[model samples]
Target: MVHDQYMSLSLVNINITSYCMQFIDSLCYILVILGLVGNILGLLIFSSSRHTSKISSVYVYLATSSSIINIFCVIRYALVLHSKTRIIINNLIGHVWFACKLYELSFCFRLISSWIILFWMFERVTCVSKRLRTLFYRWNASQLKFIIPCIIIFIILGCVIGPPAYMYQPRISKNKLSNSTIKSMNYFCGLPSTVSIKWQKYFNELHLGLNHYTIRCFFSELFPAGTIIIFNSYIMYYLFRTSYQFSQINENKITKERQRTTSWMNIVLILHSCLFLSSLFSHVVGHFLSVEAHETWWVLLTVLGNCSLNFYVYCLSGKAFRKQIIHIIQRLIILISYKLQTCKQQQQNHQYDNFKIENLIYQSNHVENINQPKSYGTKNYPKTIGINSSSPISEQETSV
Candidate 1:
């Protein structure tokens, strides 16, 4: 009975594993398609526009970075989907250098994407603050070109710690009793094992303990998320305070436009904050769970959410973005309709020319018969008035 129960449990585990893999495969494909389309559209809209405000320029950079990161994520997920299952396990174990390096690259991009959001929040806070408003407003396009690259370089340098954190080594073990050999991996990123003599001696001699997951979670998830929340809260407070101040003053077109833009920014900030917070929560939960937990799904969901939400947020909140999208769509429609009409007109002209040629041919044949030798009982052509008439042909051609 115990053996049977064990077998049943094994079967259940296998079933669950199969189902999870299938789900992840489907989700990856769906995210790849949707994320690519959405991010590309966003890239086009943000990059092509001319913005007088520095804040809008900041948004353009943010959107561009997000689109790029989304593309990277799609590629990363596609690689995982296509690679061997054991390769993925080795990645999780942190023993395969190739997988570790690939993960590190993805991690760097993820950090950049997250920091971009945090920086955007900071920019908003600066814009909304009365004291900093003048300073931020004075930031011109040339300064933006310098500032954005500097920030990007800083983010890339900061995230360079990822590769070493996930370092590992491969090993093999043998079970003497079973006379079987098994492959084992050692993660240098985790706490040193007390039971293994080699690890114990290594740890005792070096006095080092590294927990990559803990460090990564704190820096990548906790710190950035907390910063975003704090800045976003300050932005909300300042926006409300500014609204009250504006209400006290006399309303004007400029004030109204400022208010509208502020409102849109606030809405976008709130939406993005909610999305990032949810993703952070999912990541934190996945970290605390067992290896067998369906954490990949959570990770995939987080990636998909982060990649796709920005476009929707912009569409819903930014009037300028919406107008641009609408304008582009209208132009496309007009262009297509014009081409279709031109084709139709061409077809009509061709048919009218054919009709004219056929009529002329018939008239010429009738005139020829009239000029030919008359057969017995064949009446002479009456000057071919109807068939050979130029007036009717001219009229037909003119009407066509």
Candidate 2:
């Protein structure tokens, strides 16, 4: 009976795998299309001239770079995912290990760029404090000195995580040889045998750093994401309570509406917090899973999924962005429709002008025929009809 139960589960797993393999290509195609559209639109709208304020500049700049980096990241995983599925996955000149290294390097660049965006947001929040902002300005001689700090932070981050990118590789697990073992392994590769044992401690350090990063993510996110929700949510509640304290304030619907909108914005910020938290968790999971037994499926899933959550957050929670997207689409539609209508009008006008020219030509010919009599047989004939001055009765109603 136990064996029969096991056989049933195995059959189910195989059926699911077959189903996933069939549609995985379509899913990838859709993902690419969506990434292209959303990222391009995100870049364009976020990086507008009107949004170049001190308040939004950081967000816009980070959003632009994130979108671009995500596009590249998608392309990288696409090859790895396809190769694992054996669906036309290209090899690095028939060498699988080289492909693994290239994929890892591309992914590292993508991830580092995203983390930099988060750090950029931290800089923005710092600038919002009046005292710190003033001090920052005084400490520097140049007007654009704020950017220098961000440049320094990115440099530090690159130094810390840049080396492990090339060192990490994906390899299939031996446990996967038995169907009763783990469902998936990490998208991990075995290190090349050419490296010496002297670098063994470095791997140990890298593993330790990976653990520390998880803890760091948890603490970093808890304050900004969790405390933020609790504090802001209550502040809004208190504001609501105060509004009802006076009838005059309550009577002002416009003020109440503004307060309501602002309150909703706080809600959105909470939603944004949740999204980032979820993504942070995904990163934590992806790290461990990829390290233990690097399954290609989970690897691509985590990377792409974590990157994609932001796009949905912006579209769903950001009222301003939603409005901007709608406005842009409306303007584009109007522009296209107006152009088409104008072209149709021009074509009709052209036909009318040609018709007028033809009428004018016909009229001119008619007028010329009357104005100049033809010299038929050299006979002198009046163009107009003449009546005889002296009329006499003739036998045949004719005159000589």
Task: Give, for candidate 1, the lowest lDDT window spanning 10 residues.
Answer: 1-10
Local accuracy of candidate 1 as per-residue lDDT tens digits, 289-318: 434211245655675657655567646766
Whole-model alpha-carbon lDDT for candidate 1 = 0.59
RMSD of each: 13.4, 11.4
Error of 2 at 55 (Å): 3.4
Task: Give the per-residue lDDT digits (tens) of candidate 2, residues 281-313.
Answer: 554554454332222355455445545545655
Point to the candidate with the largest lDDT.
1
* TM-score of every prediction relative to native: 0.60, 0.58
